[model samples]
Target: MDDRSEGVIEPLPIRRLQESLINRIAAGEIIHRPASALKELLENCLDAGATSIRVTVKDGGLKLLQIQDNGCGIRRADLPILAERFTTSKLSTFSDLTRITTYGFRGEALASMSHVAHLSVVTKTKTETCAWKAHYLDGVLVAPKPGQTVEPKPCAGNDGTTIIIEDLFYNTPTRLSALRSPSEEYARILDVITKYAVHNPKVAFAGSPLPDLSTSSSSETSHAIRLLYGHSIAKDLLHSTFSSKKQDEAMEEESEVDDRESWKAEAHFTNANYQSKKMIFLLFINHRLVESSRMKRALEAVYSGVLPKGASPFIYLSLQINPRDVDVNVHPTKKEVHFLNEDGITDQISDTLQQALASQSHSRVFEYQTLLTGGIAEPEQSISKKRKGKERARDGDEDEDMENAETKTAASPPLKKTASQYKVRTSLQDRTLESMFPVINPTQIEGSSSGKGKPADISKSREIKESECYLTSVKTLRQNAIKGKHKQLTEILEKHTFVGIVDLNKCLSLIQHSTKLYLVNHGALAEELFYQLGLRQFGCFSRMKLQPPPPLRTLIEIAVELEETTAESGLTKPQIVDRIVETLVARREMLSEYFSFNITPTGLLESLPLLLRDYTPNLDKLPGLLMRLGPQVDWNSEKECFETFLRELAYFYVPGPLCSANPETEDQEAQDKAEKWQIQHVVFPALRRYVVAPKTLLDRDVVQIASLPDLYKVFERC
Candidate 1:
């Protein structure tokens, strides 16, 4: 053996880490960057019920980071141990963790910041006459100067909280070195504030030298998007709400104790026409901003087929799930979260987004294209040439005018040299194209006529029989089942007598039947009725004829414009538009007979479905309807296509709120009351007689008065 090997190896002694060193190690996990520290401070401000939050930064927060909020401030007595680990007002016992609804818990954020940076707080609660200020370091209150006391001192301030952090990650050279430039860090800070502003639009946010962000207390999500993201995004955004309920009654009954299993997801996403180089994803779970790579990837996959290569979309999704179903403690910083039914929820959200995108894309109006007079000849000429060439090749058939051109020119008088004489005319073999595009008179030719051809009649009506109307698909079956479950409500509706209108604003009505008083949701009843009416009158819907019907070319042009805006590779924009126009033109007979769309071959909309005699279908949305017909309707299977078409028709016929430009005015109010009376006497009774009632109205009991007993009991106590 070597002499060095002969020496005995000594065991190293075990020792506890110094308090400062231990704190620094913990700080590394929580305060990874200046943005991370700022996020924690912002969360604290929000938890204090701050309505206004102000942030200040210097050198990308590496030198200075400060946040002030006008909210209920911290108690002076709590300052001493405010930075202590695991000290929090949000939770007390272990069981309280499961029901935590606030953002900042564990009380580790401030403690971690104190260890890595200089931390100070100035706060004044409503009860306090003066503010109390304190400095902290390593989880303990510290003196600001050499001779100052190590305790909170009374100071002048507003009734809110202000937290200041300086020299973030000062104790960790490696972490400090890992950070990017100050401007980059500030960018990150702005991004966090932007997302939070979107989530809590009621709260105002300001950072000096940067534009202030604020919204009305009652502002919607779209308002926030317009204020923060810009009008471009707001204009193109499509919104939807999704919910999941237990399909099996047994499963629902077994989980009655924790009935919070249901979840709702809301999404605001850009359409296919709106594209970016990279996807912008904002995800909030239970109002907490979090990152889920799995969800991001799933959503991104949905847009892959819709967008061109390297193009992406902006998506903002907020999910309200039960606290018990989410694991918010997976990371120290809580930047990433894990949740139950991740894959299933992700798929549902993705599918919903895809459908919304398709619908939105099909509804876009391309304002640039001229409907009839301009650029219309190119597509028609191309189609006519192809048809003519094919017909001649197959049967040597030619138009009468073409075959007798010499004889007609020799026999006919000299044509008038007017501007109209130079106008070009197009001819088709049958009424399909003629209905979409009509032709003007021309010189008659006798011998050149093709005996095999029939005269094109654009005004002829085609009828769809009742047997052709009752088409059902899997989706239709499921919908019917859901509607059928409300048998008890349907019976009640059949027997009920319309009493009067209770709340016009809420569409609530009062009805009496079988010696019982009941409150009804007239809006829900109207929807159910409209759907049933659509099924019963599927093939021969009443028609609302438009006077001087709008040009069909206008609708086709709008569809073409939408397709061009959302153009992709492999198919040119014009080609896509042509395909859509062709499909709609081909289905003209089916559309007219079943949906009451009497469109002329020369691009004229003759009529539409008249669900209500006084209510006219919004013509502005007609282009969108025509555009969607080519994509959303299933043409491969007649049953599926008809089912989808009827569903869309029913949705279109659902009653809309009466228009009130100045609802606050007395005249408007009076008008609204009159309208309500009309609906109560005329609409409600009609609906009750014909429409089926849904089992649940707004997720409440539809027919049964279970809550009525509780009301009576409360009245007795009163």
Candidate 2:
């Protein structure tokens, strides 16, 4: 006890860490690995408004890392403290942090690199006659060599910025040791660049000394993905655009600024046909490449139902959220970010993706019963022979006996099984009184002849029965569609009550049931109603006669030109055009009777359907509509023809884009308001009268408002 008291009498004194050591520690936090460091540097180039960014790396950027950008360069006056911590042109005050629009705002990337490595910059402003070169060590200017002046020197260079970093993490041996192999680091580097390339397809990326993995600046996102990823992933991609404007108005009203509350998300994802060993997720928030584990997991859950047990999908999403809603400083490296309503946004995006995948699956064409063809029979016979040989060996049968049995079977004529034999072999029973009747052979019937009389009568009966069955199936399917409509109507009438309009511009009306409010898409409702009305009023449509009765040849020519432009395999442009023209001409009378179109024999003038007199469609779309009808309509089936025709007509009745000219006078504003009021009062009432509620819209119950609670939850965040 005496020895302990003598040894531990004094406490160790506290002291400030040396600047070099402090800077090195901070640097280690920001640049954890080669990929993270490369991400920071790339962001800097984008922030500079560079159209093209070139990167060069040696030994996975541990030995040397360089980036050059053709953007606004650093001025000579700012060169001395260029690498200083907390220095940036993007932010002027602490308040700016709340709304950071730039990629690199904290000004830590360069400063951190300088502490762990030797940093140099060569920059020249557009107005500057000579470029200025500078060297930095630990956030301050230093000489390139010993005994040289510790100041920037004049040099010749392009009107841009060039940054060079050497010996990265040299002062932190532990961090250097923690890094992966150079090849692995290089792969990570490429992954980061590829994601950014997708986000900013207008920007070109080039690698020096390494493979020139560059993308064309003019390419679109799809093309860039094809170039970087591969054709396999690109071919199976499904695209969807989601916006917050699609949400209930009550949710959006909670935000102080309406415009700021609205956000848009675009996703390009692989369908069920495409799979990978691991999920390749590239997410960008406001064009800044970032990661969100919550988003990744949510998206993976969506694919879990679509893909095989051990497979995943490729997803690239770009989200544009208001600056104030996003906290970019949550992580030191800014590799991840926290945004307002993270859970709500993620759920919405995941739901949208799932809906897209479901739709894609529904559109797939399956080849059923193809194995019944002769081409498949050969393989089946071979497999059966192999199985029989194995069975004989297992049973210890002699090969000679097996050969003799096969030869006997081959020599004998094949036996035709009678109807009684078929009935005895099958377990299925007709559960009706008809099952009690004995099977009668057609050849043995009363009017039977030795040759053709009974056989001809049996063939005629079978054909008549098949035709009846086919017609019955068609009738059943149509009845099912009608039943579905009736079921939706019953649910809506029983469960929901009409509420006031929320947004007439978007045709969104709020309806409440119990404590929840649902946003109804009146636009979609109107389209469905118009289609139903057309079907009900077939062959008696009201006509909107053209003033001068335009030449039908003109419409035919337009269709021909469109067909030529979008021609597909197995059909020549001229052949498609000729077929379309001939088909329309042949069906002219039928079109006139059913659709109220009046055309002359020599291809002249037609009247269109007068759906809603107040709503005028964009006449410019008429030719394209006719062109699609030629190919999309099923001419072979009467049911499909009617359904497709009604759908096209409904599409034609939908409203077009509003004029965007400035409404400078009160009269113009009043007229706009009056139009919206008319839509709400006249159009919506008429639509509700005819339109039955749909089972689903965008993977959600159309009339029930099942997700109304989720909408309320989103507003709570606001």
Candidate 3:
């Protein structure tokens, strides 16, 4: 037809003739890009509980985006009209949208997709003897392709549906042009998959070049991540457990008691260690694939007192609240949602996350000692696997160079002491992250919310409510606080989001430092546990006999005052000793700080009986014994232990507990306490020094030093 004859006579847009074409145009409106389209289909498959998902993408779904599922398949009779607009089997009436829990609703995803893309529905009903194949164009049943007509053919297949979207946006060039590169597009896909993969651990997801797949995506993803890590992410890993019950309780408590709860709530407590992103999977209850600004801000606030100022986390939160809780009709592409309990949900989530995170215990085991010599290998296994894999075979010098370049970036790993830990996260991870999950990157807190210098103060951080996950009971919460006053885990105990475990080698790669244990949280785990346990519940009080040491006293003073103490009292030797003792006794965590220490989910603990075996009712009692025992004594009573600790603090002021002890001990208190502070602040890099570098952890004295730079060549060569 001539241009003049076409519906577009100049100004007004050209309108399609048939209703099917009209429906197809509408379909395009719903299914905007490859990622958006994939989101809808994936939702459906997930709702069906398919354990394994295989996603094949070409040109980011422009050429073809195929997803096959093993869920209950579709009926043959419905195949012809499946592509039609406003048709769905998930719900029969309009009321369903109010409680639409499934991923697909509005009956528009398939219909809208059919409009602009070549659609194929190959489905086999669970009861059907064979699968039926049908094709559609412009939301209407038609030949599979042009000029091809064959009745829906029977094919052998398992129970499920495979949806193929071909020539996406074939009708709209402008939209397609806005898409990113293949790697970038795939990144978005990976983003989508990652959110789903972690959210539903029961389900496995993988994506590889079509017809060129070998290993599992999780394995491949883990390895590729290793290549990008430049430095190991974690070491000293332990098992973890996550229960939605805690999340739900938190949700309910917020909605009811705190009045911050939402129309619906879901909590998740995972028993597995996560890599460094502080991973979170967020799925808003009422909306699909979107983020509310308020929600983000709310999340930030909840984590504010808990996480450091700049640090954030990788969270995959799936919220299932009343539809009225959120307005999904806000965005054209549905990337944003309006939440009802925006503040409530965010607070609940952040608080819950804080608690979940605070429960982290790092005493994870590695190097299994079996009668037959068997245990889960170290994370370096991933590094070694890289050398033996196809990546080593196919991606030669050029790829290595590119990776080296990526490593040099802010995210890359750098050279450090052999006994030190890596920097945790680098830019290499940032670049490779998208390849693993293309749509959205995982949450990262390093340099983001790391609570750099004194975040307000412990008092201010304590001002917020303690999350449920970290609390054993209200009384226990109170007891925990009392316990923490003796030690100083206030900074680490309050957040919920522990990074994954790492081995000594991996630990050295991630951080350039020596730390028997360390934690980076906005709040302290000891303090958080205090609130969770509700110390009031535990009437038994083993009061802190020790005072803060000099250096620790200064830090605590700064935290409390946000200013340096200029008073002569702060400079007094006796006062300095008091502060250090109190801080150490109170803040120690039994679980390993190194991420590689693997421990049982429940067995992982912050306190060990051995560490708490000694105490003293009176500080004077320790000195009498020091006179008899030559000052340095490992007391055995719970009460005497506390006193012995206090005596150390007294040393901070006057050098006496060690006066009768070793000749080098008098001045060591100040230096050691100062060093510990440096490690605590993350200001000093950690370093471990061994005599002769044994192949594994078993070979070293494993002295926890303050900084990597402190590692002597003797230590390094060891």
Listed in order, each prediction's TM-score against the native is 0.50, 0.50, 0.43
Q: Give the C-alpha lDDT of model 1.
A: 0.68
Instruction: In angstroms, give how far residue 153 of model 3 lies from its true place.
Output: 1.9
Model 1 TM-score, 2 decimals = 0.50
Per-prediction count of colliding residue pairs? 9, 0, 154
Candidate closer to the true structure by lDDT (higher is better), 1 or 3:
1
Which stretches of candidate 2 lie above 4 Å from their native place?
A: 1-10, 247-257, 362-718
Q: Quote the lDDT for 287 in model 1.
A: 86
Give me the displacement of residue 69 in model 2, in angstroms.
Answer: 0.8
Residue 246 miss distance in model 1 (angstroms)? 7.2
Local accuracy of candidate 2 as per-residue lDDT tens digits, 1-718: 6756677665679999998888888888898887788899888888877766778889888888888876778999999888998898989988897789899898888999899889999998878999999999999999999999989999987657889989988888888888899888888887888788888887768775444366645578988887678656886888889888846678667754366667899999999888789899999998888889999999999989878799999999999999888888889988789888899889999999988888776544432211100110122233345545544454454545655676455569864222111121111122322224464442232223345532112222211111122344345534545765645343443344445455545556654443344556666666676776665556666688877877765665675675433332235766656666676778888789777867767766568876653445557667766665675555646776776677777866654333353566765555444444444444554554545544433221133333332333355458
Which segments of candidate 1 are over 4 A away from where they belong? Answer: 1-11, 212-218, 246-260, 362-718
Pairs of residues clashing in candidate 2? none
